[model samples]
Target: MAVVFDKPTLLQRIAPIFQGFDGPLVFAILLLACAGLMTMYSVGFDHGSRFASHGRNMMLAAGVLFVVSQVPPQRLMALAVPMYVVGVALLLAVFLFGIQKKGAQRWLNVGVVIQPSELMKVAMPLMLAWWFQRREGQLKPLDFVVAGLLLAIPAALILKQPDLGTTLLVVASGLAVIFFAGLSWKLIIPPVLLGMVGVVTLIAMEPQWCAPDVDWRVLHEYQRQRVCTLLDPFKDPLGKGFHIIQGMIAIGSGGVWGKGFMQGTQTHLEFIPERTTDFIFAAFSEEFGLVGTLALMAAFLFLLIRGLIIAMEAPTLFSRLVAAAMTANFFVYAFVNMGMVSGILPVVGVPLPFISYGGTAMVTLGVCLGILMSVAKSKRLMQS
Candidate 1:
């Protein structure tokens, strides 16, 4: 008795790849991506090929997301150490021989110009998570000390490139992993309190500290200027303060209901600086108004909450740490960009997650979302 088995159809063959994906997370991403496209079209309409280019980047990012999501968490854990090593080696190479653009030596040229600091954003968390996973059941004070050393080395290297923004992000992601790995609150409170005190002291002494002749030894001259400008943008109105002032005007002009898409005076009249890049949040606010901004923030909040849920449900320590750290990355990106544009924080050249225009950043975002999806999928599969 000869029996024949039916071959799987294309849909059936590929079904496992799509199986176990978290629906709410996917919906949140889609909602943000749509908002990003609409906002880009409005802001980039007259800004050469930005709108088309942005759409292309989004497609490329989606491809990345799909490809990365297919990889299981165990594979990601295995890749962590090598990725961190390669990223750190590239950073050293950039330090030795890198391309200088706008007075910063941050880009390295192999076949193409690449910012090594950007790679650290993902690598730092991965490395720390891998380290903690290795000592999962029996972690010690020395383990955390070793993790801090790992984080500090790359952070110090990037800071030497004078890329403060990327350094902040890398440090934040690494720290998030450490925090989630069961570090004691007793060790965390002092530095935070000291930081708060330092901030208050700086604000109180701004007049003296920002004096023209005063030179801050720890900060580069441009960095010092940024802090001073943040303290009082009106002090240099048309000089260092131009970006912040213009951004605030655009945001305020949007009113409660917005000026309508493409009808932003500050945006179209060219009053806003970097209208399609770092300051796109201002352009978005100008055209969409308060209501639109709240809705956009809500989408971000949804993504953050969903990511946390996924992290908590993740089966392994590596997946949990990675998910939480990646979620922190998104939060920092949005908070820093919005804070700078609103004149509450210094201009640090951070971009709004989906709304900002940058191919590299878009690709990085795709990787983050993919990791989250992988973790979420792993949890569901284990349950089933």
Candidate 2:
């Protein structure tokens, strides 16, 4: 007697690739992606291929997410040091031979024009997580000092590029890792308090400090202008304050319910600057209104909470640290972009995640989601 066996189907072969994915997390991402597409279409309907370009970028990001999610956590850990080193080296190259655009030298032309600082956003967290994982059981004060030095090197380099937005993100991600790795509140509270004091002092002295001939030595002239504008946008309503003023108007005009999709006067009339990019939040607010904005924020909050839960459940220190840091990155992106658009924070060119149209930023967001998925997958597989 002979026995026969049925061959495995293609779905069976591909099933493993999609197995172990976190369902809630995927749902959250889908919600954001759908929101992004709708917002993009409304804002870019007549903006010369922006809608098509955004769709293409999103598809490319989906590919990046799929490829990255397949890699296990251990493999990601292996790539940490190399990624950090290469990222830092590329930033150095940019500082030396980078292309200058609009008074900032942040892009490097290495076969393709790339913003190297974007790379550090992931690398900083990965490197710090890897370091803490290596010193898991026997952490010392000096270990944290070493981690701070590791973080500071790349941060300082990017800050030199004068890209304050990216610098804030990289620093925030790195600091998230440090905070999760058991840094004491005793260590954290002082700097935060001092920062609060500094902000208060600056607001109190705004009129005097913003006067002509006031050269803010620590900040670039444009950066100084941004701070002053944030304090009082009406002072230069037609010049330096145009973006903020327009953003605020669009947001405020979107009363309780939105003006209906594609019916935003401020948006279609061209009052909102960068309507499809940095200030997309304003465009979104205009069309969707306050109700839509709250729903959008709720989606973000859901994703953020799910990510933090994944970090807590991760088996290894590396996975936990990386997950926490990446989760914090999303918070920073959303907070900074919304705050700037609503006139509370200075405009720093940070894009609203998912909704903003930028290829590099979209790809970077994919990588972040991929890492979270990888970490979540690893935990589930270990249990089974």
lDDT of each: 0.94, 0.95
Candidate 1 is scored at a TM of 0.98
lDDT of 2 by residue, 106-146 (tens): 99997889898999999999999999999999999999999
Clash count list over all predictions = 0, 1
Candidates in order, TM-scores: namely: 0.98, 0.99
Q: What's model 1's lDDT at 132?
A: 98
Model 2 spans > 4 angstroms off: none
Name the runs in model 1 displaced over 4 angstroms: 1-4
Query: Weakest 10 consecutive residues, lDDT, candidate 1?
Result: 112-121
> How big is the RMSD of model 1?
1.1
Name the TM-score of candidate 2. 0.99
Instruction: State the weakest 10-residue window (summed lDDT) of model 2.
Output: 45-54
